[model samples]
Target: MRVLHGLEEIFAAKGSLLGTSDWVTVDQARIDAFAGATGDHQWIHVDPERAAAGPFGATIAHGYLTLSLLPMFMVAVYRVEGARMAVNYGLNKVRFVTPVRVGSRLRGSTELVDAQPLDGATAQLVFRTTVEIEGAERPACVAETVSRQYFGD
Candidate 1:
C-alpha cells in the first residue's frame, strides 16, 4: 500500500500511480445482496441458470455494484496519516468497460490525478481508478473519483 504522511504528500504525488489493491472476488452471494439492496434484480446479474444461455456465459455483476467497491478498493491503495477524516465528494466520470462475471477476482489500480488544497485543514483529491477483472484484457470499470480529506488540527 502507498502511505502518504500528510495531505501535502498526496498533493505532491499527483500524476503518479498510487497503489494497486488486493483482489476481491465478485461472487453470487455478494451480487445477490447488492441486488437486494439496490433493487436491481436483472437476470444477468442474479439468475445464474438463465444467464448461462444469455450473455457473458454466466451471471455477471451490475456495473454499479462494481462501482460501489471503490471505497473498499481505495482503502487498500493508500492512506494519509494526518488526514483523520475523509468523505467521498463525487465521481467525475465512470464507465463499465466490461462485465464482471460471477466468481471473478477484481482489484483496483489507482493513480493520483489531482490534489487541490481546500482550506487550512482540508484538501480535495482526485483519483483515476480502474477496476480490473482477473485475466481480462479490459477493466470491469474505470472511474474518476473526488474526495475531501480533513486533517487534524
Candidate 2:
C-alpha cells in the first residue's frame, strides 16, 4: 500500500499503479445479499439454476455491485494521512466489460489519474480503477472514480 503524505504529493505524480487489493470472492451468499439489499434479483445474478441455462452459464455479480466494491478495494491499496475525512465525490465513467461469476475472485488495480484542488483544504482526486476477475481476459469493471479529501485547517 502507498502511504500518501498529502494531497499535493498525490497530485504531483503523473500516474501510479497504487497497488492491488486482496482477492474477494464473489459468492452466492454475497450475490444474494446484494440482490436483497438492492432489490436487483435478476436471474443472471441471483438464480443460479436458471442462469446455468442462460447467458454466461452461471450467476454473475451485478455491475453495480462490482462498482460498489471500489471503496473496499481501494482502501486495501492505499491510505491518505493528515486528512480529516475522505468522501466519494462521484464517478466520471464506468464500464463493466465482463461478468463476474459467483465464486470468482476479484481484485482492483488503481492508478492516480489526476487531482485538483477545491475550495477549503479539500482536493478532488480522479482514479482509474480496474476490477480484474481471476482467469478472465476482460476486467469485471473499469471506472474513473472521483473523491474529495479534506485535510486539517
Clashing pairs in 2: none
lDDT of 1: 0.93
Per-residue lDDT for 34-131 in model 2, tens only?
Answer: 99999999899988899999988999999999998998999999998899999888889999999898899999999989888897688989999999
Per-model TM-score versus the true fold: 0.96, 0.96
Off by over 4 Å in 2: none
* Model 1 root-mean-square deviation: 1.0
lDDT of 1 by residue, 1-153 (tens): 889988678778999998899999999999999999999999999999999999689999999999999989998988888878899999999999999999999999999999999888899999999999999999999999999999876
